[model samples]
Target: MGIRATAVACLALVTMGCASAERTPVTSTAERFLSAAGEGRGGQACLLLAPEAARSLDDCEKQIVSVGLRAGAVRGVDVWGDEARVRVDGDTLFLHRFPDGWRVRAAGCEPRAEQPYECEVKT
Candidate 1:
């Protein structure tokens, strides 16, 4: 193959490798966010959010950190198409599976229409 063709082929291979969800892909990127939050890296955690969720709040990372919610593990993931809900430490999180990946819509949450994010974290 020509140099240009070879380079393109190599690029494709690299992309495929980087996009390796071949074996046991994460249930959702929300899990990664929780891991990040648990480690107290709000900015990194905030990066994995659903667009609407991202837009719904201001100063996303700092706001999360302010809530004294470092992070929690996703005990379960219930995915139905683009939307998914996760359970963590008795609290639940809402997420959306975007074209790119999953993002958190709400955290420290429960399925309560009246008070979704009422599971306050200790400061």
Candidate 2:
């Protein structure tokens, strides 16, 4: 798959997807992540990321804080099972529900024509 497709594929799986109450927590996680990043709290932001997504970067803590991520008004949310897509005023985020709570798997994402969202951070 193309690099962009990776982000969407993770959201495309659903044999029995439905509107979920998990939206609130999921959106909160994404908001907190962006808030931390925008505030230069790299460690805190990294704490909210999925493990693999965190490890995907050579220097996750440093890179995550510098990616220009920002918290904005939440525009929409779509949740399916453990996965979620949250649209903010200026960004798109993907998240997963871990055993502890919801964590971001991708952030600072944007869609291309027919391609998956191109994410600034992803696993």
Candidate 3:
């Protein structure tokens, strides 16, 4: 391959690697959020939430801790573009990718009847 062609191929490989890397951070963010909430570290949990999600609550620090969230083994993770959903035991979490990293947009979510998952905290 020509120099330009080789450079493009290398760039493509690098981009692919970066794309897959998102999975780790996304899963970790969700897990950390749940762990913090479960452990009664409200401040740490709030830090993992999206800015809008955090602001949506009148008392994020107090309310987030009392939402009955729990940390369990991650059952599954689906990442598409800037959005991600993680399933942890009985709870489902939705996250949004931000400039800095992924942040939880919703947590303590449960299935509903033909509707969006009902969430205890959402943006």
Candidate 4:
């Protein structure tokens, strides 16, 4: 009886740890997106897209490569429910949740007074 109770408690602890842990599923998703961007794999980046954007962005894989964005050095990831914001340098990339995973809604950078520095369409 004591061993069974201990086993149950351990399982519960593992479950809780998996949920609130810093590197939760959202974080992993964010990391993968950034890593693909770092490698200049736009098609892979598309894989992270919220459905509509993914469909729209799929055609232009070269754009992803040409942007010269590097994702491997991400500073941090902020997760708020189904939405997560990934910080690369000072820029913030936005994403939406999907049954498949996370998809990019927008990729934002600082110095808000922009000059079309961002291409809203991944294409």
Candidate 5:
């Protein structure tokens, strides 16, 4: 291959790798959060939530579990900057990267026509 063509191919691969790296953590955080909540580990789930999201609930631990989150097979993930959306079998979750790591900002989301997603739990 020509040098220019090789460089372009290498750049494309690097870009794709970065995207995959970002998506992995986002997917992992969403799955972990859902699993924790679904399995009645409310405290663990709450710890995975964004600060403002956790504070939105009066009782973070109890209320997080009551949200009825489920851990399903992850179907898709989109990461933009420090924000990400993960779509699983029965749910979509939004998360933001923090200094510590990624944390769930919203969950149990359903799309609406010409509107933002309505989530059962959000920041």
Candidate 6:
């Protein structure tokens, strides 16, 4: 292969690697948040929420669990800058990267027809 072609291929590989690395943490955070919420560990789940999102809840611990979140197999993860969307078997979650790490911005979201998602929990 030409030198230019080789450099392009390497650049593409590096980009793909970066995307995959970002996705891992996003997916992990989403799954952990869902698991905590689903298992009635509301306090744990609340800790994974963004500050605004957590505060949006009248009672973070109780309401977080009562939302009926389910942890299904993660089907897709899309990360853009510090924002991410995770799609599981029956749910979609949105997250934002914070100084500490990724935190849930919205959960229990359902896509609407040509509109933004409708979320049960959001900030």
Query: In candidate 2, what residue range of length 10 has the lowest lDDT sum?
Result: 12-21
lDDT of 5 at 123: 90
lDDT of 1 by residue, 1-123 (tens): 999999999999986675444211334565677777767787887787666665655776776666655446557766666666668675677766667766677777656676635543211
**TM-score of every model versus the real structure:** 0.62, 0.82, 0.83, 0.60, 0.97, 0.97
Candidate 6 shows a clash count of 0
Candidate 5 lands at a TM-score of 0.97
RMSD of 3: 3.8
lDDT of 4 by residue, 47-116 (tens): 7656665566446466555555555556777767777766777456767777776677665444346554
| Residue range with the least summed lDDT across 10 consecutive positions in model 5 | 22-31
Better of 1 and 4 by TM-score: 1
- Local accuracy of candidate 2 as per-residue lDDT tens digits, 1-123: 987798677666442242444676887898899999999999999999999999997888799988999999999998888889999988999999999999999999998999999999998
Model 4 spans with C-alpha error above 4 angstroms: 1-19, 56-58, 111-123
- Tens digits of per-residue lDDT for model 6 on 1-123? 999999999999999999999999999999999999999999999999999999999999999999999999999999999999999998999999999999999999999999999999999
| lDDT (Cα, tens digit) per residue for candidate 5, span 74-104 | 9999999989999999899999999999999
Q: What is the lDDT of residue 25 in candidate 1?
A: 33
Clashes of each: 2, 0, 0, 3, 0, 0
Give the poorly placed runs of model 3, Cα more than 4 Å off. 1-20
Q: Which stretches of candidate 1 lie over 4 Å from their true place?
A: 1-28, 113-123
RMSD per candidate (Å) reads 10.0, 11.2, 3.8, 6.3, 0.7, 0.7
Itemize residue pairs with steric clashes in candidate 2. Answer: none
lDDT of 6 at 86: 99
lDDT of 5 at 59: 98
